[model samples]
Target chain A: MSPTPRRISTSTAVLPADGRRQNLSLVLQTLRRLGPTSRAQLAREVGVTKVTMSDLVAELIGEGRVRDVGTAEQAGPGKPATLVDLDRSGLLTLAVDLSVPARLQAAVVDVTGTVLHREERAAAVDAGQGRGLDPAVVVELVRSVLATAQHPVLGIGIGTPGLVAPDGTVRTAPNLGWTDVALRELVAEATGVPVLVTNDSDAATQAELSTSPASQDMVLVQVGRGVGCGVVSGGRLVRGAHHAAGEIGHVTVGTDGGETCSCGRAGCLETWLSVPRLRAALDAGDDPAAADSVAEVGGHRLAVALAPLVAALDLSEVVLAGPAALLEPVVPVVARSLADRLLPSLDTPLTVRLATSPEDIVLRGAAALVLWDRLGVV
Target chain B: MSPTPRRISTSTAVLPADGRRQNLSLVLQTLRRLGPTSRAQLAREVGVTKVTMSDLVAELIGEGRVRDVGTAEQAGPGKPATLVDLDRSGLLTLAVDLSVPARLQAAVVDVTGTVLHREERAAAVDAGQGRGLDPAVVVELVRSVLATAQHPVLGIGIGTPGLVAPDGTVRTAPNLGWTDVALRELVAEATGVPVLVTNDSDAATQAELSTSPASQDMVLVQVGRGVGCGVVSGGRLVRGAHHAAGEIGHVTVGTDGGETCSCGRAGCLETWLSVPRLRAALDAGDDPAAADSVAEVGGHRLAVALAPLVAALDLSEVVLAGPAALLEPVVPVVARSLADRLLPSLDTPLTVRLATSPEDIVLRGAAALVLWDRLGVV
Candidate 1:
């Protein structure tokens, strides 16, 4: 017997009850992307009635999320319309980044994504035993950032290295020696605010997505002490079925075996591409050929790892986030390798470039988590 | 200066104007999945009012897309309710499959996805010169299939081996010796039915998706004379920016180079995994070990090509569509290699299996394209 076709609905059906939230999110997102605009202009831009636009704007203003920023210059207009914009100084998000090995960084970010305050501390780690950062230390760092906030804090967002569940539990961060640490709960309790935790690479991806004009389908590779990636397809972050969508660090790359990884795998991507390994290779000697060879091998491995992704998703760009010196040399190698692997297409050539804001990417991405969670904006 | 966060709205905002089409599609999809359904039950399941559901159902019935079944078995009810379902016999779709080399296959499929009539003809090919099927032959076959239709045909859907543009242009089907051929226009002009052309691998994916209970995130690999993949992420088909998504046959897999492909690339996935090569290796000798080695090497290459995709997309399953003898042996090798490459996780193990309906997959998938395009039900 022929099997019946079980077609699943992929329609964009929205319930009437969710209309308000959807409209509100749309309005906020519009303002965030296009900057300040007149109420009438917003109604036209968002395709809502003038009355509905007025009500949404009023609600945002009353919530201290928006403010009337004087008036706009007339361009052959009847009157100068008062401009409404997000209140950048009224709300704040405390962001923590635990991606750096043996270090902790935090920042107070405003609504406009401006970092008002920043702090860093050396993390105490049992390096010999590979034990990760202490839970208390992470909580203290969040509190320390919270104490420096000058505005009403919306939430605390932490981007840590590990497999983070949607509920903010760190399933495992081998580099940090963490297993099932309730980082979000600890930070929220210690600081008395809502908290969101995500994989640092995903956070960085969000930050890159929010700050750059990249294509909706792109991957951000985070090369630090450990290697990971954040993937975005169709303008949405790809959190895998197991929340391990970008866990590429441990994927064995090539047939030829190389350095061993902490995961007990030889020829893993991390062994070839991690910042520590690249830096070690560079520091080995003044022999540029040796350093170049390391970069070449790492780049080739990275290309091997990324080729399938590029082919499968038809990715337009690959953004590498790390020290430019280490990654820049690797870019050409990756580009060449990808060209060799994928179909030769004159149009839609894949580009590999460094992240523009590499230094503060994770911190800003952590803030994006709070922004998206609390306000449904970004 | 820090850049402002440009948050694109990913909210499911439906314009009031689009409400009607969305609801109608929802109802049709519901019927297609659950068979016959009562009006009241459909309203409840779709979270819409009975009046709205009735109006949508009436429109579908008037269009001859749906029909009312006599009655449903009463379950703790005061009276039996009339059931509504898709009119399987009233409408038919003409599907064409030009994927098999030197063969042209066509089928007339009804709403229930049953093949009502089928026909096949040998394609005229300049084998020595590598010229593919003549366009006149394809058009003639479509005419023959349309003439046999017992009911009104919805459209013509084609699954061909090529890079198809959204406009139904066969941008390049090297197997068919077609370049920038306006296939949809040519077929529609001759048959007077709207035509949709898509890559055969993508078509097979649609057929598999519509027939099986596979995960939303999955990839279907088609192995015949060539290799290609169809990727589905988050329940939606991934059409790349250039409409070249899932064009993975040419991607080089391993470091060691092997036989050269027609694309002039050595060690392409097609060079290692195509059916002809596997068959040639199996026929090269009576030794089982040699055939096993061919399968092993092909399996390893496939694994290398897929590991990054698995890690990047966090796919839940990989479906192989081809002859059982050739593909079944390659499954375990791919699974074991993926396990070696990816992190070990007990929660979401990726499954690799053979497609259940390999013989009629492309033809059925072509019908699915018509279904999704015309009714927006899939």
Candidate 2:
């Protein structure tokens, strides 16, 4: 997660202006993604009128945010039209993934979700716990990464794992031993730049806006040392009143209170499904193939746990996140359970598939969060 | 639930112009809730300026939505100011609760949440199944109740006990043995009014909004013949992506997976906490003080099941649907587990409470749904 910017997304002052400015940015973003395209193509692509497209393009050019690069190859037409696009050097963003355990990971992203420069170093958070992670070291890591950058970093978005209040205070993070920590203030103080803090799960959700096969309504269950889920319901992230809507790891899935969890409770879904537990469970299973694996559990229980949710929601798909070794065990179990419990009258079952976002889903999400923030999508 | 007024709610042609009208309605609702108040009081009460209030009131009076009543004694020594209120005679509303077994509950509400007239009929749903329930009979029962109404009917809102779609379809209701049933269409066809469908639990949530000391963020658990929950996250009803976010009944609280549920699942939270099971447990237990015989045994298992969620969401309050026989036996178990599992770092313990609404919460919620639809709150 890059640090949050100095200014909030969408100035309250600018909000009263006609929404055309927002539409203009959207056009720039779309053109950057589709590459240089003619004005007619942009109008159709952005679902805008030719006049609106030309006006928006003019505004973007006036701001030096877009360019008329060249002409497209003429097909059997009158004459080839010139293609326009977002100026490659328009804006730079800092994508920071605070979920990375060992260090602060930072990357510069352009208008298109393309990485400009990326680096990582030991995090200072460990030092704050007196267990070796230091905030200063983490600041140094980001500073060092910034050293190689040339573009003005418009904003920084950091995706931390825990409950993040909208204002950037980390309300609570068990892993980092942080509670009510004004993290963005400290990050900005350290880096001399704007800072933003968001839940790591939400960052992963923002990552989806850039992935292929855009989801209509999405669920992202991130499996790591601990487990969490990020939800996109009704086309927006589910940020509950307390900003803790995606904390699904602590959902109790066992009535017997089977295993103790770090949350100081037994039978917590996270304790059973976490990487450490799955590995432990695999170690307990005694199968040669499953030995020393996190994915060795019988997927049956997991399927039972999630079935009702799927049935109740009438959701068509879910994206699973985790190393293949960890999630492999539960995939088939989820598949079968989904097939059996669907309304018997329905001919097809819901799809439960692994996230195909490049292996760096969290990293990608962190970057996307920066982009969304810069553009004020929310 | 009164019928949903689709014709008015979906008038895109009235956009921008309606935004002004909508603000006036917002002002009217605020006044209804606060009772008669001066324009100055209205401005402060509705979170608007005096100028905005004046503008809104003028439009509202022009539209006959509000009227000025003579002044009462001023608390302080200012000139007695005229008081304003919703003009009940401006528009009439009808509310219906369709899921109350053997009953068709109806009421009239003005722009305010006040009840004007109340009526009900003995009715049942989906009698075709051995459960002796019939969807058709239930529909007709609602029709008959509306037949005696003196005021113009608003849209109808039906609160069922199971999953509902955004478009008002009853997707799968095991208790009612209904599937892919177009409830909105049926109610519309029968009453000649548009309709909205909500789960009983979600309806309870809406009902909470009208009560004193309203919950900002809480969970409402309806422990009837079946166990279900409505989540108020971000202070809004969490309808998930497909309007089924709170299907905690099938959350698998028991690791044993020994108990079976009507959903054909084993070890669902509903199997143990539902009314029948709670009653059975009380009857079987030797404890003399266990007078609240749940139709079955509902106990610590429910608390344990809720443990993970408490830890996960860090939710501090829970509102249990009340009734001496229904809620008394279940509250303690949930409270103990919630308190015991809370991490020491959290200063407060999660609370278990009762709904302020009546035993016919779902039915009342059904009625409110109609009001919200007609008034365009939903």
Candidate 3:
């Protein structure tokens, strides 16, 4: 199914001002997708009147967020209408990814999710030191990224590895040594820019959802430093009561309670399925044979952890986000494991694929968060 | 958390007609919960002008779905305004529960989900004979219940155990020996009344959600003749792509691949958690020690199956639907098992409780389905 924007999809009554904003949002989103397009075509696609479309486009142009570029090629129409497109060069977004291992990654991305510039800085926290990324270091990184942006910065979107409240407070990030850090407020106050703080898994899931419009319901498992998952059900992000809905890493999969985890628990899914563990297990074995065996075991374990979720949510697809060498070997194992467990009534096969949004999935996801917040596009 | 209705909550733009219906739905839902209320109070609660509220109430009264009673007692000031309420005596709904074992249970429920009348018949199906409930038998059961209704029949809502499509087609109900059954069409045609067919678990979940608005995200595991679950995520039923989202019965939980299930799966959750198997296990035990031991193990297994789901969806509650003797002993066991597996960030403890709906959850759920479909109340 084509991705349906939440605003117009469900016909509900709205005040005129709210309705106008919704129409403008629809117009902006369509322009992002279709590039330069005639007002008439844009209006038709957004199911709005041409007059309303013109007014919205005019407003955007007046705000210097959109530009009219020449005229469209018409076959035998009355006139060649002028094409309107987003002014990509007019605005920039400072997107920061604090989920990277041992590093804080930042990027200046445009409204189109195109990374305009990028930078990376070594984070201050060390794993054995029992510390996490310092809030000051993260702020410094954001400042560095903002300084490099040539265009006007719209806002800052930070994708962190932690339980993030909707208001952008970091409840806890074990690896980052952070707890109750009002990251959004801190960043916003320091830089005088609007800010959005979200879990890395959720940001990645939003980006994945935006690209794969066909599959509205999916679970994206990030097997990086930890084994967290982001769930998109019924075309919306399933943020739980405490904003930890998709934090699946700590859920125990091993019945034996094998290894103690950072959370003071045994047999956490992360202890077995995280990238570091998988790599270590492979390294402990003899070259190819050991890696293959480790992959199979890890895949089977992942399937065990995900089967209940797939069955419970009736998810149509599962995507793995990690190095291909690690993820590819696990795909078939997970697929076979799920096939054996799922009900026959679920006739439609659950497709397991890798994330398709290039190497900077988390970075792009951070940018997408800003897009969603500003435009209501997602 | 209070249950937030979808409409107007997000402040998104809506078309006039849709906005009107949404407002109307809000008004009706409020009346359903609050009983008779003055229009000014309702207008204030719904955030609409008194003129709009009066217009909406007038339209509903014209449709014979609402009525105005005499004025309320005089307050300290001006005259009391007339009160409006749902026309409970104006229409009735026939709710059928075909999920019961060898029994087709039904009721004549009012708008408030009050069972005015009820009837049950021996469903024409024998598992030993490999025969299932005939569609004709279900239709006849609905007609029999409709005959007893004193008010105008609003429609028929059938809760069946199977994969139901949005249009009410039963893709497959293995226990019912039904495949590709146009159940809604069959019943609708027979009685000349509108019909809705849904998975019994989903219906039960809806009813559970309707009554318990505080906990919007929950899982209701119906351990009756088979093991099935209904998921309520983001305050709405999580109906899967094939309408089998919560069909966890066939999802293999045990690694042993123990007994072969009716779905041709081994070590399925149903093979271990189904009511029949649990009862048989208790029956085979010579004493309470053995029975309690079996219950403890079963509860652990159920917890293992649910831990991943609880983590993945951040579900706050799990409600078990089964005989108290069977479910009560399992609750503490399940809780202990989950406590060992779940992450600490999920600070809000997961509560495992028994179904509070008396004896006929599916029947009430069937009524809820109609209420939700017609008034957008749920």
Candidate 4:
């Protein structure tokens, strides 16, 4: 079902009518954060009366969202209280990503962001470029994953490389030759499941933001088929007015002529940092020094483009979400470039790190969208 | 007093315990947004019961935060309801700025963001480097402003440059030569008034975001003594992890060493776009063509740094907040530079506009900080 997308409020202030919903959300989030815990502990943590917490727990249990997982060992209390936690196996989320180069990946995940079953297939390549991939292929992948899901599926999420509308339409994806594709509606109609569509980088950002010890203000740059970015500040993804906020791949990096971009622009960051472009540049010459130099140049260019963002947003961390082989060398160069330009008085030094298996990050983020939208898990 | 800095929650969800408070905040915000209105209309607009709204109104009136402003004219056959609105004259806010070059400016403003009085004094400059201004002078300015306030002061807001801690400490302001100064505590001690402190650019961004039809995702670039940016996304200011978000001055724009910056870096955006630098470049050559060319180059350099941010954050607007003489010439140049690089498929055009009287914008924003913190007005 194509549920209407609701705009996320920037203000963190709670409302009167949302009191019960907020409390329920807090309980669920706490259960996810703290793992198995007692109702008394939850009541204390959530600032609710024990009786009220019991009621909330009962409602969650009835909905199959939480389960009573035995009792805590008594240390000093007369009676040990029953420990409850999220029912990880109780629900499933289907996530798919079309942003991966030459392949379409899908996964069945649980409410806790654990991938239960994963699948992928190579798309028929056209013209040596990532193009002419059929939208029906994505729809089929969602259906195939749904068939294997043993648990009740909460929703289906699709992350693609493009500007996505709130209503889940792909406004444009030059690499995939997709424009105004109603991929969300097609998948939902074929599988009869709730579907969410977002730009792949935004999905990856959401996944990163949901991780433990997550910084509320961070930037996740996914350097794969495209060199896009996702920004999270004040705990919300910055979906631009045109829903093209993370299209850093097309940002101009040089005035001199370079390789042409998919968006018809020359000298774009994508031209310099895209996996295919980097690979081609590496393949052009066999000398190790040349390769190292190329990697350094790529990293330096990326840093130059990103340093302004780091400063403008006061970002806590910059994550490179891509293959280690391609992004690892670039990390040191990028770090050095950033240090060279960034103000030296940085007390909490801006961290630059390589994300673990960012290929699946967008898929997980797609699942997170379902969790965030359907269950308010975030 | 320096209230402990409260961390902003990324989640927009409301809480159960905050029901009454949220309702009160909504009423106050609605009154401010919609102007004077009757309790029945407010109840209908806020989706609260008339009885509950009446109670809220009574509480607000009793607290002198709202006032009954006569009765609405009855169009239908019913008793005229009493109109109520925010008591604009009930509270005053004192705002100060250390971000201004060679001066400490302060203002006494009403709750409605109306400036009632203003004063400025040149700070003792050191070696014409825009440094050596003592934090004690800022404290004295706040005291002086507080002395002249005609109304009951809600709080004092100070907007300075460089990194600011949540506890109102100026971590480092190379321009002002401030380091770990407890300006908030000092002002509070000197005047016995509640105080809030923040980066001046952040304050300006807040003021801009509070304007009519404000875009939630916007950037305000203050091009003054030092070039810094203030970012607002999802309706909240993005104060980074180190409280140094929006420090864009040192972001390197070129390889050719121009002027060494106070931060000991060369080829910074500040070197290219700061008011003093541009003025010097203009005064160095009297040719109008050369001045236009210089302005264009400065704008292009700024756009190169900012385009990535625009693409990364999906910002809707980029505001140049500075003196018209310096910023006006750069506006069209910045717009052209951005237009040349930004993807052509953008549905919502990114706007570049000059801010109206940016010097006062920080002062207003400081007042806004007090409003946001003390009254939850934002």
Q: Best by TM-score, which number?
A: 3
lDDT of each: 0.83, 0.63, 0.80, 0.79
DockQ of 4: 0.37
TM-score of chain A of 4: 0.91
Candidate 1 Cα errors over 4 Å, as ranges: A1-13, A48-56, A127-131, A189-192, B1-13, B49-59, B77-81, B127-132
Looking at model 1, the pairs that clash are A132-A176
Model 3 residue B62 lDDT? 95
Clashes of 2: 60
Residue B279 error, candidate 4, Å: 2.6
Listed for each candidate, the true contacts retained, as a fraction, are: 0.46, 0.17, 0.47, 0.52
lDDT of 4 by residue, B1-378 (tens): 012112223243344445566567778878888899999989988777799899989998998999989988887988888899889877678888777646678999876677899888887655346467776777777778778877778888988887888888888777776678887788888888788988899999888876643787788998887788898776667887777788888888744456776667887888788787678777887787777877888898899888888888788888888888867889999999998877754676888998855557888889988887776676
Q: Count the backbone clashes (under 3 Å) in each candidate.
A: 1, 60, 4, 3
| lDDT score, candidate 1, position A228 | 89
For candidate 1, give the DockQ: 0.37
Tens-digit lDDT track of model 1 for B168-275: 889988777778888888898998888889999999999988888457888999999889999888777788767788889988887777788888888888988989
Error of 2 at A281 (Å): 8.2
Against the true structure, candidate 4 reaches a TM-score of 0.92
Q: For candidate 2, what is the TM-score?
A: 0.82
Window of ten residues with lowest summed lDDT in model 4 chain A: A1-10
lDDT of 1 at B362: 92
Which scores better on DockQ, 2 or 3?
3
Q: What is the C-alpha lDDT profile of model 3 across A104-221, one tens digit per residue?
A: 8899988767888888888667746777677888788888888888976877889999888777889888778788899988898889888988999888888887777677678999
Give lDDT tens digits, candidate 4, residues A69-149.
998899794889789999887768998988854778999998767888988877764634646678888877777888899
